[model samples]
Target: MPAGEVRLVFCNAPDRDCAERIARALVEQGLAACANLLPDCLSIYAWQGQVEHAHETPMLIKTTAVRLPEVIGLIQALHPYEVPEIIALPVTEGLPAYLQWVRGQTLPLDKSA
Candidate 1:
């Protein structure tokens, strides 16, 4: 595990459509190498000083630290909620090849600057 290199962002969507749209955007923008949709997620939380409950679609996004900000920003812009749940947690360890593949998949095609 490399310091400041891995990130696991957590975000939930009220509907499957929103989740899928976000997932497509993430992969297309190179913000995430892949997104696993967890359907039938039972979420219970408090909002606006009240208890809330709903079935949401959780998206498990796999990306690198460098692209996390961009990914979050995109989600925020498209997310319907007034305050979307977008948070990134660092990955302490992962498969070497898988991590490298994610990084490589998201890297800019043009290396020259």
Candidate 2:
């Protein structure tokens, strides 16, 4: 895979359990190479013309660009929020081996070998 093919996906879950569930499913299903559940996050945003605040668990997901669509779809299906925070940023640079590992890890089961 090329450098720009890797993506860093950011998603926030309602809590630690939800974060863990999403992360595990992503990795186990080969949709993501890794998902790091970060410390509690305080999110303040406007919704339905009203301001809201909540504690969330931020997740940093690693996967190839090719798998981004599946990653997003799965998150949407499992996420509790009506509109979950799912964003992907291109990884322009990183350790070569690590990037390769991510690409390999996210490949479909048949293609991984």
Task: Note each model's CA RMSD in angstroms.
Answer: 2.3, 2.4
What is candidate 2's lDDT per residue for 1-113, written digit by digit as tens? 45339999999999999999999999999889999999998999999999999999999999988889899999999999999999999998999999989988987666555
TM-score, predicted candidate 1 vs. hidden true structure: 0.89
lDDT of 1 by residue, 9-101 (tens): 889999999999999999998888888889668899999999999889998898888777788899998899889998888876888888888
Please give the distance, in angstroms, between residue 62's alpha carbon in candidate 2 and its true position after superposition: 0.2
Error of 1 at 99 (Å): 0.4
Residue 32 Cα positional deviation in candidate 2, in Å, after optimal superposition = 0.6
Steric overlap count per candidate: 0, 0
Could you say which candidate leads in TM-score? 2
In terms of lDDT, which candidate is strongest? 2
Cα lDDT, model 2, residue 28: 94
